[model samples]
Target: MTQKIEFIDLKAQYRALKDAIDARIHKVLNHGQYIMGPEVRELEERLEDYTGAKHCITVASGTEALLISLMALGIGPGDEVITTPFTFVATAEVIVLLGAVPVFVDIEPDTCNIDASKIEAAITPKTKAIMPVSLYGQPADMDEINAIAERYGLPVIEDAAQSFGATYKGKKSCNLSTIGCTSFFPSKPLGCYGDGGAIFTTDDVLAKACREIRVHGQKRRYYHTRIGVGGRMDTLQCAIVLAKLERFDWEIEQRMKLGARYNQLLDKHGYQRVKQRNDRTSVFAQYTVFVENRDAIAKQLNEQGIPTAVHYPVPLNRQPAYKDICHGTVTAVAERVAKQVMSLPMGPDLAESDQQRIVAALSEAVKIGGF
Candidate 1:
């Protein structure tokens, strides 16, 4: 085995942008306005421009973004938000935190995205919103979901935590639905050095509501307009994101090329890789695939100096906390995918040679695992 492959090469990314990142950090330190400083608004403005959104509200984390979005929409007790179970817990966690119900939906097996075709059946009079997780950094069926949302007069919130730079139908992911939320957790496509996130909205009222909700619902300092949370993104984190923006475009392109190459390589060996829709693109935050004997294969990869991850090992519907409430949701697909899904090392810094090595190792590991 050669040198170990990093699951996410943040070190390589930092080394490449050391100067810009240092400058950004130093500027933030000199200003000393750590809370809600100038960099916060600056990052919001740039992200708005990047996503073509009317407003961008910086928040403390991806979970905060979802919470703020839900609060802005006035989701509360007894209200339901339709979402998939095959995603990070945050997607459903925020809904539960707000005293709302997360109505679990099945996912498309190939894409691991919320199955839009199955969403309508779950919706009822209590459904206030449709929250779709763009699992694995590929936008879900937003157009279909949006159409369904329109008919029901329900708002759509896109959980784009893993897909800041992805596009769907010629539009950016975080700008697709009624309110789009993205994360800047260090491993995300457009991550900062630490936890951060943003909310994108075209509605002025909703945007204003989100902005206030992030800061304890204050329209002005020391004045309460409504209930809110202390969810503002830190100034330094915003600055770091701004610095990362310098190379973000190049990185997105690299992700596309690398993701395409991985698909090609994996396909040549008859591996069941995640599928991407033709009308959209995935940032491949985690280049996932299905396999038999997952644990044994992962152990083999580990022994061979390659890192592997399971984006999700259990569907939210099956989790101890959610099982009772989500009983009878009937997500056979999510349950099956959770067992077989595995993520390969992915990032813009990933080398093609490394991808070849990984694929070859995986092919052999599968054989050894009795597949």
Candidate 2:
């Protein structure tokens, strides 16, 4: 009998770190400071130390992190933020919410990340920032993007929602740009039990602005300075993250190893996957592959007790809501890949035996359907 596999085995992770997590939660319960408790600062300091960034501001969610970062920069209507079209909607949604246009650029076919070469051409006088999503837990060509931003005097905000714990050129993903934002959504690599996120920046001035923007633009308890949002991650969530952090490094290591193992297995079976650059390490937030007849394949996998998912099926430029707002330039690569990408079960707790079974089942499914 084949063992059942979980797409992301959060239960396994919880089991592995239950004691610490429970203690942290109990500590929070005893204090009764759910909103911005001491654990909030403690988590921030731990994250800052982990990423080597000068500051880390905990926020309500990854979406809020982006919005607050943009607000801190004073990005309002008519400003253009250049970014990839092939990521989660929140990447573009945050820009649109601020009344800024997300200038959609095509992604690289192999990695599904914003093509750094294509980014320079998208810049205009109205371009305020370059927001790059680290799709599938891999950082984009941040160095190249940063160089272009420097030439144009623009800030780079890395939408690292999927790439936390990943390293780019020996530097962590969230610290690769002017402002780095990450999600702690339950499914993310370093997720909390609920919505949580953090902003990373080496710039003190920008850091100050982000901190103020998260709490109704307050420098003091009741003082309001600039326009802001009520975007504060609760104490419970912070405590959960702190507990998870205790084993984060080891989990990231497991993800890397599993990703490599997946690569080897898939390659042996003549399957193609999203490419990882040599200079960077992806946390494999979602281990994905290129496949056709996604619906048929997914159905087959479901029947076999294997599960699959599509990271995205439509590019933002093609979505009805965004088609009108984003510049009408066609992102051919994004459009093509969106139709072909499919995610396999992935997590730090994935067992090697389960991984082999998943690959074998996938290989069999692909061959039988000729997809």
Candidate 3:
């Protein structure tokens, strides 16, 4: 009998680090400083050093990180943020929640990242910032995007929710642009046990603003300086992340090795996947591949006990909530890719035998599904 395949295999990871995680959690429990505790600051410092950023502010979630970054930059009503329509709704959701507009752009078909070349044309007088997502653990064209932002005097926020451990041109993902925001959701490349996120920035003013914004916009206790939300990451969650950080480097290395192996295997089987660029390193957060008859293939795979998922089935611009706002915007690439992308089982602890079995199942499924 074939062993069951796990999509993310977080349980295996937990087992590998159970002792450390338990100790960290127990320490937090004993201290009773559940909010804004010492572990929170310690984690922040470690992340700041890891990413080479001037400051790191822990937040309640990835969405909160984006909101706080936008709030710190004074992005609000009547403003516009240019971003791809291919990413998770959170990227655009934060902009809309601020009563701002999200200008939808197309993606690069091969990489599924925002097409940086088209960004300049999307800029308008009302455009406040450019938010580019590092989709599927790969960085967007940051150098090119940053150059365009500089030309228009706009700030660039890297939505690095899936690309935490990735690198772009030798710099870490969350330290690549003006303000970088990343998620620590349990499924992400560098995840905690629960919802968590962080914002990285080099600017002193922006960093100070983000720190305040994460705590109800208060510069000090009970002294509100600006409008904000309750977005602080819990102390226990921070401790969990700190414990996980101990093996993060090793995990990233394994991801790279496995991603390369997957690429080679898929190529041999005549399967197509998201292409990783040479200048940057992707952590392969989802290990997604492009396929025809995605629904049918997924169904066939599931019957064989192989897990599969779709990172996104619809482009944000085509979604009901955003369609009217971004009316007439053409994202042909995003629309086409949405129908073809399917994520496979991926994790640091994935065994070679499991990977081979997954590919074998996929090969059979593709043939049976007539893809």
Cα-based lDDT at residue 19, candidate 2:
99
lDDT of 3 at 135: 97
Clashing pairs in 1: none
Instruction: Residues 1-371, candidate 3: write the lDDT tens digits.
Output: 65678898999999999999999999999999999999999999999999999999999999999999999999999999999999899998999999999999899999999999899889999999999999999999999999999999999999999999999999999999999999999999989888999999999999999988888889999999988899999999999999999999999999999999999999987788999999999999989999999989999888878889998999999899988776227899999999999999999999999899899889999898755
Per-prediction TM-score to the true structure, in the order listed: 0.99, 0.98, 0.99
Full-model lDDT for every candidate = 0.92, 0.92, 0.94
Q: Judged by lDDT, which candidate is best?
A: 3
Better lDDT candidate (1, 3):
3
Candidate 1 structure quality by residue, lDDT tens digits, 3-107 = 899998999999999999999999989989999999999999999999999999999999999999999999998889999999889988988888889999899
User: What shift in Å separates residue 229 of candidate 1 from its native position after superposition?
Assistant: 0.4
Q: How accurate is candidate 1 locally (lDDT)?
A: 0.92
- State model 2's lDDT: 0.92
Per-candidate count of clashing residue pairs (backbone under 3 Å): 0, 0, 0
In candidate 3 the C-alpha lDDT for residue 124 amounts to 91
